[model samples]
Target: MSIATSPLPPTEAKEAAPFRPKAVTDFASAGLNPALIESLVLKYLLGVGVASGRKVAHELGLPFGPFPEFLRGLKAQQIVTYTDAAAANDYHFSLTDAGRARARGYLEECAYVGTAPVPFADYVASVEAQSIATENPKEADLRRAFSDLLISEDMFRMLGPAINSGKGLFLYGYPGNGKTSIAERITRCFGTTVWIPRTILVEGQILKLFDPANHEPIENVRSSLLREDDQDDRWVEIKRPTIVAGGELTMEALEIYYDRDNKICEAPLQMKSNCGTFLIDDFGRQRMAPIELLNRWIVPLEKRYDFLRLPNGKQIRVPFDQLILFSTNLEPKDLVDEAFLRRIPYKINASDPTEAMFRRMIEIFAPKLGFREIDQASVDHLIEHHYRRINRPFRCCQPRDLLLQVKNYCIYNDLPLEMKPEYFDFAAENYFTVL
Candidate 1:
């Protein structure tokens, strides 16, 4: 659960109309049948035993419009009766025997009882309005996203156009060269935040969308604060999502995952990553073969939309409107065919750092790793003996990783936290013992 709570960057002059889901003011605007809403209300009451009219409405994320008035209709039919008055002239209501039986039936059908789901149509509209394809990131945006890393000018030039393509690219080369790090930060080049539904209602089925493990919510932040009830609560504002799937990825993960006992569904990874970025890390080493995964995404890559079948076998078209990055140690040509390679326009190699760049990284990371300062002699000794002697290539990650090993050794031995030639030798001896 990566949390991106940073303030959004300045918008470009050509920004499109901002997307905001207005509070649904009626049953029609909610796009849900009244009977469905009624069933939800009853199920909520059955679970809690008793709650205020306003509490129920608030729990359901429908505090506006005729939702309260509809509750009165339930009271009129003796399904619910007022126990006591609540704040703001609301009433404490409890379910009758008939209501409890009905709620049990509804539970038997599907037991989901959290935030009300936004209609599938509304969700589709939101994705189109907030798609990353509309974004045009300039050099400044790329620099800001990669501010922490040392990006060479040539690499920056290659990355800017690739990010702007929004179709995605392959970040391929040697391992430990920051391919994953670069892929993770690419989303920051686009807009910082976008709204997504907590859950989606499609064809009478509820699909959970707001995964706490993937989406980070931005509370009380909105485009405007003038109106108290300006935006819909059904939708949550999240830091533009960067969903990463590495070696553990499987074919089942690409489709709608249904929980039989809960009678609930979790949206596919790509669906949750709409309007943001999806990184397929360690691409060739997934649980499934590379060709199988590539075949699954061929149409979505070309069409910018995907078709996913529901549990009932009905196929639904969903927007595939995210930057799909594939990060791998293997070469793009070796892992995928030319046809597949053509789909991904850019194939930027994350080459190993030059000797000078490697030393620069050591200088930058030493103090951050709690070393007071580093001497030139230790760096030279490290490069000359540990690297040159073994004919070892320089990796962008070696500076930090090797430094950590030295630091840990010093801490264990109660020695001063300073880089010394002896420490580098000790660190490299242990570090390079493995492949």
Candidate 2:
């Protein structure tokens, strides 16, 4: 198969020295049971053949306190031995025949051997600690989040309460009018980050939670709510996630996913999006029927909690902890009945820009395209001749699209980047060719 399924390169055999934060000074602090940690340690040794106690802790992404004591016990039991005796607990450790046999048994059952999975209970609890309900974003927060964007006071007023409520809203309007862009920026209001485990354990199965595409890592994070010393490295600190699932969003993707052969499970989309924003971009047009998608959330939307079943048929409750946005170019009334609409109470329209707003967008974007002196007369000329004559509605994206055409026209003619009525004429003729 593909390169992603190929064998991963072996991690370092010897554990490197890593500083421990005060948050996780012991196994209890890491929120893991002793037996679970031991299984991961043995499985890793089975794969690597040798690793130091420090390395084992580091690789497991656990605190060092419990490892030293656990290693001493394994050493006493003749399951493992320190290859070298050093004062710094730097003995390169290797497993004995007995330890390898035990590791083989562990592998036969689950086969998870990388970073240890955080207990599922701990995961649920952490979500509650950082739930979007706990966040109260102010107008200043929204403004700061969307400082560079062209959002009006009316739209901001509508968004402020909806965001503060941390509930679902419909951002319906024409395409390319910044519904997706607005959805993307909703996370910035909370402006705080939370810690999530890389892998969550559910009944001996590994459920990977951290996704690089959705979760951005921060160093020297300056959020007051989640301190580095408040949680172990087992949990990675990320800005509240803004997960956008477009037309490809399926009902299966919204549930617990398991690969029996691989012995791995994937956390449902909502679990990964906890304490963040989950925008169903192009919501009504998803592969699954709009009714089916809305039905799945009926209970979760009201109770603010969801239930997912494990492979073993065990139903587990997880926090439905994100502000859900349904962005669509289609009319909301045409997509869902009144009952569904009521559940999604706030339906805001991101309609076409007014003439003044359109001009402002052109003025703001023109300088970035190397035209510092944007000809006001040329802009007026384009609006009067092109838009008014044709009775065309101005879209927020038109300025960028038409300007690029002007830039290209200048480039092909060996001319400088300047806004002129003649250039707008060329841009409009070429840009509106389809119409």
Candidate 3:
């Protein structure tokens, strides 16, 4: 069950496509079928390029001998190209363009089934409106921050309609433009429940129902059977699930791996992120290419479900009911073309804050970070000294960082936390760009 084989050829010519079998029974009743198995294998090959046949076999709970035959079948269809290292008795498999298309098609088909609506009766109704008794100070603080920015109500209104339409979002701007902060605020405002796969060993066998094509977790199925009286307190809480992964996500980290003793392969990030928000923060900056990432998600984003295969040749469909938000500082035109951009419906541009908002931010953050006396005179002086004189765009971090530096200076010098010209000079020198 090791996938440490050598590289396979990119493609083979004059090969016929492999036959894709259909399931005889419902996915739940039949457990796994040939089509599901082929789809899962295809996903792994596409995601990881060439993996070890033995490793693939173990993960799928299939006999190791059948894997080479599967690889041969895939190779014959020209979906994958295989290289046999007779010396090592290892066969490496890589997906061709046709293979990739087949895999994507399989995943797209799976996504539809995964996104099937759950029974409404299973959900309990919580208080819709906020009450004085239940009001949280943290929420008030967030509201205050939003109010201070004076963001147009029209801009805010677009969020609901866009999400309701089940379209992806693109948020872009320069650094310090509050894009990340706005994403956090959206999550806080909507409330979010993080959905992680519920894995358990039943009869010494691992069963996962989090497949995007058929997103039926054991918990979801159990919840459906509950009586109304038994489900009074079990309302579906609307909480946004936020997953930030990119710089840390490697090719190996995105696929299934074989475990010999347990005889199982675990689901990857995309599968775990079902029914939640998957935020690709600092998009176009991951180790993988932006096109590669987009290609991986194209099917799921379009269809709202994904099919993932187990190492043992079992394909599982999972629901993809999550808000996907791509936050980047790079220009959209530079990163992706017009054709690709059309797939993402909501494009929110977050620019630098206005001077009034900037000044207010300075006043609010400065005092809290121990700048005890930040009068309007000192604030204006700092702004004029750094931004106007040096011709640098005002950064929100500057105010917050400058306040921290001033506090550290006060503690070191045994002085009160007062905003002086000296502290401003230090802050301006270190944080602001001088012309």
Candidate 4:
């Protein structure tokens, strides 16, 4: 299928450019039913009571070509009447009694009244065009994405190829070792932004896709008031998503969610994370068994497509093109059998940091935590007394946690923001007691 593409050139340096969806002028080009568009106009008019032709078109995100002519046909049917003259040769329209009744019937079926949903076929094409598998992250891209972390050279080298693979991987180790953090940053290596439909329409069911909580929308700038944007407003430009699902994830979340009350459908978690990354954080800790969850995604992980059943019992295939990262505190072998393990090709251990790396973390975090200076003596004292003496293994998160304790103590005791050996002792005593 020939899909419409945006004319805007890529602005991001080095990152893979995303495929932008361009504006469509007619119902056929927009992949919308003329009958459906007419119903939407009436519904919108019923809601607001009175609105201009341009306003109705804008609200529906169908701002160009033959839409005004289409609205004129409603005026002929006596369903819409002109209330007042609007600018740009348009008129304010209100729904007649018959029109309101028709809209009420439409609402009874489904009350969706937003940007007309992109057709499912169009959404599938967008995912394939912007698939993460198409992008290859060099060492520079990895370094840029993970610049904030203190990753050792060996770990850095291991991550690049896995990200390049674009299949899936496991990040397993003990807790507080940056498994989730690493998974979240993996999307940055691919690109900065991608385009997704605000909602998708399949067999007349609206599937709400663009989520403000998970997807951050980038607003479009108009070049002039005389001309509308050439790009499709139905598709939102968003930062490359890194959707994290943890212990709260349920088996139901991996499928289509139909809201019986609203008569609308919500795209599942994997659908929301398309063209980017989906991090299953605290993987083994979810309510479902690891094997069950693995079974659900086993086919999609390899085939790069998924099947979802609508409330009407009709099945549809959607592109499952995302970098899946499974992060857990438990070992991979303990979570699933060898067959499942083979699917997730890379298993990188988030091992405990060396004493030197731990010290570096302390040095990096000390200043950020309001310590005026790092005392080499105080750090050495902290390591020797708190860690070495107790035979405590160093976790990557200890520096930040220990420093917060010391900082809070300084505030409580009205002491200077200095890293004193005594402060380290106090912090270590309180911080390590539970762990």
What is the RMSD of candidate 3?
Answer: 18.6
TM-score of each: 0.94, 0.88, 0.57, 0.94
Report lDDT per candidate. 0.89, 0.83, 0.56, 0.88
For candidate 2, write residues 122-186 as lDDT tens digits.
88777776678867789999999999889988999999999888878999999779999999999
Q: Which ten residues in a row have the lowest lDDT in candidate 4?
A: 9-18
Model 3 agreement with the true structure over 139-198: per-residue lDDT tens digits: 344455366444545556655455444456888878776677666555444332322222
- Per-residue C-alpha lDDT of model 1 across residues 88-183, encoded as one tens digit per residue: 677799999988888899999899996788999999999988989989989999999999998778899999999999988999999999999999
Deviation of model 2 at 127, angstroms: 1.9
Prediction 2 TM-score vs. true: 0.88
- Itemize residue pairs with steric clashes in candidate 1: none
Q: Alpha-carbon error at 216 in model 4, in Å?
A: 1.2
lDDT of 2: 0.83
**Candidate no. 1 TM-score:** 0.94
> Cα RMSD to native, each candidate?
6.4, 10.8, 18.6, 4.1
Off by over 4 Å in 2: 1-22, 28-31, 85-87, 220-231
Worst 10 residues of 1 by lDDT: 220-229
lDDT of 3: 0.56
Model 2 alpha-carbon miss at residue 311, Å? 1.1
